[model samples]
Target: MKKTLAVALALALTATACGSSDEQDDKSEFAENGTFVYAIPADPGELDPANAVLGATNTVLAFAYDTLVYSDADGKIVSGLAEKWEAQADKVTFTLRKGVTCADKSPVTPQTVADSMNYLSDPKNKAALLGVLIPAGMTATADEAAGTVTLATKDPNPFLLESMTAVYVVCGEGLKDRSILKDKTSGTGMYPLFTSVANDHYAFKARADYAWGPGGAKHEAGMPAAVQLKVVKDESTAANMMTTGELNGAQFTGADRKRVEAIPGVRKGSAPDGIGEFFFHQGDGRAAAENKVRGALVRALDLNELRAIASGGDPVPATRLISLAPDPCRGDSVTGNTPPADPGTAATLLDETGWKAGTDGVRTKGGEKLKLRVAYQTSAGPGVQAGMEYIAQKWKALGVETELVGSADAKYADSLFKDGDWDMAWVPLGLSLPTQLVGYLSGPGPDEQGSNFAHIRNPGYEQLTAEAAKKVGASGCEQWTNAEAALVENVDVVPVLRPTQLVASKNAMLEVIGGVVRPTSVRMLKN
Candidate 1:
């Protein structure tokens, strides 16, 4: 009787195993069978963590790399490689996670963390965009025995964690080859790069041992075995790919929004607009220092119109440097203060600066033509180009000669500052936290130790930025408020509207993830 019962139990177990196998296959039909394809609008300019300035490159590279900590959709810092941290009076200690390895199979160590931070903070590293992440005079040290690192700052810097959100740690060995920055990436992220078919075509496979997944990530990730990202420069191409099932996800432009939303299985994700502006080089010893001319340039701009041009007909206009989300300081105050878009004011200011009209009908001051060259990174979108052309026309009506110079991506750093040949240009500044503004405001330039880009040196503004860096919570808020106001009143840049980020995905093949889904988040997805 015992033998007969055992035979029956074995049959039942086999039947149960068969049923489970069928269920797993049914649930994973799309993810298990197919490579998740994505259509990115442009080629990722750089994959190196240190050199990726454009959003497109950062979006893709971030998946293969990660910062120390990142805010989830709810804007709270969850762990990445470092499990948790403690901040004492003089030292900040981060406990490193174990079992995580880089794409090249190198283990993540405290020394690796220290080297990455040190490189980012070094002025010689040409990381001006990342300079804001380090506190002035801060030094990094590693305790290998404890698997911890302590960062000591000369002064009490309030936004250290916020800064770390931008600096992704890399293994010392991987960084020895900086050439990868120009074309590919290698980091210790959940996804590892597998192939680079071309400039815009790449693929990655999930690392089975990815230990630092964010809190509450879908267990198992049901992670796709393979992922593909395709470069499609035109918005229409990306939008079409979403409909035809060629792309599981993409970022949409104004032209693609209506059509993309019309698709049955797609949803949209949005991010705060990046700041855009027409920069005037004040260090050139030219007319940039003339207050009336600066005021006139400010008065002639219609921000509402400029916003429309910059967003490719998306009409959201920004009034201040700070975004209008959460507890932004008096962002509403700017709504009523923007200067009128009147050419008469521009002409009057030019007259006051002694730039009277000459026989050629162009403004002339001290034998120099009122004409100035306006340069922009050729990589800037159609909207940015349109905005520049509009401003050139308005300035021309006021007897100003404006010549537009377009530059390639490689020439951006040199053209903007090093060549020092430009009079004005449209440059975008990306500052994650309020304190990072110091690089543009007070840091030494290439020739000098500090960069006064706009040649804007207000002792008051510098002091306020410094004070903001020292305090936390309410005290920090107060200092930032003062610094923000000083910038607006001084007319630092033309103060064009900020830009937004848009990501679209197909709903049928996969579930849309939630929260502040950046392009980096999109790249890391399997389904």
Candidate 2:
């Protein structure tokens, strides 16, 4: 679960370009058949949807696989593999669209979708999206005659249908032999894997016969004949490539954003990546285990300054946990809910909590010096590094000895969950639905195969979320907002900033849904 969260977080940080639909309606402005080339930060190692945990892997998977359901730009559930779906508290039923076929020309049956769901639901498979997308202990039953797949969960899931949008259904053959999926595509998507060159590029050829898409969208004249995702690690290089027409689309977040935006023919857009949040380790034997200590830690640092530094001077105050597009609940749960930045108050709180400053300026409680290990992902770039350093300096002034631990994306999850080496971490868990975050904010720890890495045990949060789960979809948003406020008020997690990621495109217009390029939304324009 830690690895899964880490990989998903990487997806949130890396931005992708999208375009408007104004030019999409004109068939004369469209290119009949041409390859659409784009940029990805890293090579998606394995192509298997079930085993994919890296953002790069998921990015590639999105091109080759189609989910059970599709989430439109407005966060509405639309047609995909399943034309229509009915979601209940503990049960969800999907009616499979007729005449759907996999990459191998195999028929995509209700049983096929059921098998994929059951595979992820089973803990023995060890798929990364087990509890994240597919609910834990979920079972699926297929009614082939009715062309429907029914899912049953042990506990009620309010966003059951919305969650299905993330589950990429695997075909029967791929389910039997998972190794073929490592580098090949097998789902009923618009494209199939054509070629894969590790660390270089992964190419996909569009399925001309394909007609079913989100909201019954079909492969038309403007759609690309093939899609190529090139691995370009440097943001500047990607931006430069976009300028020269070498790449059709690419996302830039660093200093290269200005360069990409300056391109004459390129179309640019922005999307909310996620919140720059801080999570305190509430595990036993940790100083942050105390609520007052957590509050003091939050109060010690100037969040506004840190937000500016972290977002590279483009800071947006985060209100809710669901920052990504098509967010079901858009209410503000952050304002007036967290502790304000006040060094004096922080010192006083720490002193009141029995921590007294010594001659060396480091506070001590019961002969133990106040020390903290702050961990953050190095791949988050220089801005995050500066932000983490800024927090350390502020804590140092507050008489707290702080050690900054910078880990790469791959090792960040282990540092937080497996090793339990850090006292606090700056890892943003982004999701479209607030119900999806319930597990991460409160629940079992890593040892119990749960995503609550911080080991946060807030009764108020748990109770509010429990009630929120009972309500269906956005109707429970008010309770969900209050639930998030509980975490903020308790200092369980501090959402500091919401950063906007920029993406530029040339000769192509694409739509970014849930922070990824929607394949069906790609329209190659005539240059």
Candidate 3:
């Protein structure tokens, strides 16, 4: 039987059923290749979704796990493990899809779903998804007899499901002992972990019995029997592999995509991705805490020029944090919100803020010279390091000393959270909805906020998001947009540019969705 995927996600809670139909295709022309070769920028350490904070981790692990709800290319929630779900101000009810099994072949019940929720909601577990997607004060109750799991949140969360796309549901065995996640696999997803080679590659085998997937996507003939993530750090090496068909797909962010596509038997998978930016650390003792200082630091550079040289003009200055397809509040929040770079205004702002210019051109407040430490991840690419240095030079021109430091790939998260070493940093965090950023903006500080790396505390934003959370979908768009605008206006976040992520595949044979390669969706014709 063939059917079209659901548009508006059907909600079936408590004795009801979501009337979703599957669009089936006869596996006549589609070919099942022996293996699908993939190349990524770097190894996102550990497969454990709970402790993994990197976006690359979520993007890769998504192929190995299933969420409660799935999203379309446009960031709209469809259905995943749960047939349909109902959301409320503080409560969410989910109706489980029967016969879903874990990667280990264990039956997934309503209780199994409840356990995953409870584990993620616990504050002590330190799950990165906490407060980012699941929220802070969350609890769940499972009624196996009714086949429903009700999740109770402390407050209104309009975009919970949209954010939940990052919450990869796992079984109790791995949930209880998260350390096993580094070595073991457990989830009712499309593929299971097969073998992993240190700093080199990871292989996964497809599951035959699995059926639940985003928008009811299921395994078919063209789906690869196995998938390999080959970690090639160099851009040219990965690009050359894509051209040679040694790798089926490789992620390309810069103008290098053109070079790859220039070779025969190569096509690009293009989509919107979050930008690179320097988030101001506004916590106490942080140099960029004051709004005026933050403003000066942002106004010191011509962002267009920096992005041009750094990213090969492949990036668009961000308008909104969530730039995915089908976004409800899709508009230019960055244009009017982000001001034009003005060195004159920057100089003036610094002077008015009690920082007097010294003979060395560096400003001094009392006796201490105004110097800011800007940290960025080396793993982001050489372009990021070059861009940070460029911005640092621009700051020096404004009579402010800037220290451009790069964190090693291993200590990326620690430099921001553990060490408290950076005064400013380039960290791009994106979600499907505006409300997803609420927790990161109006939080206490980084030590307390699981996702608020900036340590931002905007009181007005708190009020706006609280009010908006009471409404759903576009009903709350204006409020959420205004709240984000406040962050830009106050110089809490000065985005360098939004990235237009591009990937190259051999002969355009692979179907990558939302910047992820789901094994279930990939089609390979027999060569």
Comparing candidate 1 with candidate 3, which one achieves the higher TM-score? 3
lDDT of 3 by residue, 22-75 (tens): 122323355555687888666768788775554445556866889887656555
Better of 1 and 2 by TM-score: 2
TM-score of each: 0.77, 0.93, 0.82
| Top lDDT hit | 2
- Count of backbone collisions in candidate 3: 3
lDDT of each: 0.61, 0.83, 0.69
Tell me the tens digit of each residue's lDDT in model 2 across 335-405. Answer: 99989988889999999999999999999998999999999988788999999999989999999998999
Model 2: lDDT equals: 0.83
Q: Candidate 3, clashing residue pairs?
A: 3-23, 74-325, 74-326
